[model samples]
Target: MNKTLIVATLALTLGTTAADAKTRLLVNCFWPSSHFACSEVLPAWIDEVERVTEGRVTGIIPPKSVAPPPDQVAAVQKGIADVSVMFNGFFGESVTGPLVAMQPFVGSNSAEAMSRALWRTNREFFADEIDTVQLLSQFVISPAELYSQTDTPMNSIEDLAGRKMWVLPGPLAEIAKKLGSGVVSSPAVSSNEIISRGVVDGHLGLDPQAVQAFQLMPYTKSTTAFSTPIYSTSFSVFANSDKWAELSPEDQEAIMSVSGEALAAAFGARWDKAAAAAVAAYPEAGIEVVEADPAFEAALTEAAAFVTEGWLKAAADAGMDGQGVLDFYTSQLAQ
Candidate 1:
């Protein structure tokens, strides 16, 4: 071969090798495209991953969720998608440590603060709990509140007992059941069906943003606010373990730099802004808000005490000092 021909061949080979080296992640968003988790949070994180890796690491979210919310973890594990988020509630016995964030009356009203605190708590205590995937970050939405669609407000245990309620599954559902409310439990995404049809007289598990996102405002007449939130939903962002292992060490480190607590904070901040906007629109929406009476708050707390007790037992069975971890998480939120 001529010298010029040989040089050109070498250049072509190098370009092909570099192209093959790039890793493009398939990130799946289970929420609707307009939802912040899909529209903003996941996209922003993907942008940062691409930026920090200098184009070596990049990701694209599918136009629609690759699987239903409950099936997300399994889909990722099977390599159907490279990345996704799952609600911890759906995992049931498979997940325990993260339930600390879900304990009734434990989490803060600020999603950002609760998210960052959950991440720190996970690192300090529950690091080994989630071993199925490459854990990226953990986040909690703003606390869930009790909303009544009837003429009566959920001011006391008796009011709650009289109404049939739709509740977000898991701890909130369990709490409602224990309170003797006629409970219809399902995923938050499906709340519209039951509420719009008047299948339930009240709802027990949605933040302000969720009220707007899920279109629950029209059916909701009033919300009884507690001194602390009744519960919050916890979620995990993760990558398929095999796909994660395929990345170079440098690229992996770059991704982590933009994830972990940083990603949690970003998600939480978006939630706070959206919740604030929804709450600000309440008056025009004709939604009434009333603070829980002090006596009523204490009574509700007493009724919901079993949720924490159940979690503590599960945590202890898993060899975790459940109360210690809970105390640590709450202390972080206080800061």
Candidate 2:
């Protein structure tokens, strides 16, 4: 009986050793297979990582794989998967500097400005939050717009009051609350269920491609262009801490070369392309597009200042000098 047990142990050890010898990377995505970024951004990244590493690394994004967006960061930290996106709202009550970029009227063109700011954050303030895993890159989603069930235009906050609107966490929900809407936060995966069942009168959480990806048009009759980017979700690529540690310095450098800010540049370019497709499809979806009056846009700017002050308070409590980071970030953006 002792001899037989020893043989079984040997066989199990050999099998485990063999599996560890092979290089593997498993990526989780927050969108379905149809999303341009999931299809294009992920595959190209896997190929580049493999090419740069000379086949020392390989990856796959299984179809319908990622569970939900907000849960993805925790999944990576627990080593459930190699890498995926994370929502900024989950960073507790404080840590709101990152949330400032999401405030309405922060910037109309976030692709460039926000992406650079993220690169800076990763190099500086975010190390502790992301210490569990190796951070590859941080980037934001496209600008969010209001999608309504009727042609009642959200031209002003007064227009948004006394109505129901769907909003996710972070500054978007805060904006919705200030506007007097009953806020509803839904996972991207479950957006269809809530929107279809009248869980919300309208949704303020989607970018353009979201209209088709979530099949939102069935519940949407109109869309209002935000005065500026209302909110942009943050995403980061992460590898399990143990897996990252096992790699050599050369391999680590290679990973950063192919991932992180390099990949972030690719992310911005891809969003530019996807945004065009989303804009083109709005007509076919029979959704009316409306632009807010200039006066209304100015009022939103004032509300944004109020929210900005709150973010400063939150950031200070987090032990980060809010004014310093914000000032540096905006300066780099200007230069």
Best by TM-score: 1
Clashes of 2: 1
True-structure lDDT of candidate 1:
0.90
lDDT of 1 by residue, 1-335 (tens): 99999999999999999876778999999988878899899999999999999998889999999999889989999999999999887776867988899898898899999999999999999987888899999998878888999877889888988889999877778777888999998777889999989999999888989898888899988999888888888899999999999988988998999999999899889989998999998888888999999888898888889989989999999999999999999999999
Q: Scored by CA lDDT, what does every candidate get?
A: 0.90, 0.72
The CA lDDT at 266 in model 2 is: 78
Q: Tens digit of lDDT per residue, candidate 2, span 149-242? A: 7667677778777678777655667777876788887666677888889877888777877767677877788887755666666666677777
RMSD in angstroms between candidate 2 and the native structure over all alpha carbons: 5.9
Error of 1 at 266 (Å): 1.1
**CA error at residue 243 for candidate 2, angstroms:** 0.5
Candidate 2 Cα deviation (angstroms), residue 304:
4.0
**What's the residue-level lDDT of 220 in candidate 1?**
87
**TM-score per candidate:** 0.95, 0.83
RMSD (CA, Å), each prediction:
1.8, 5.9
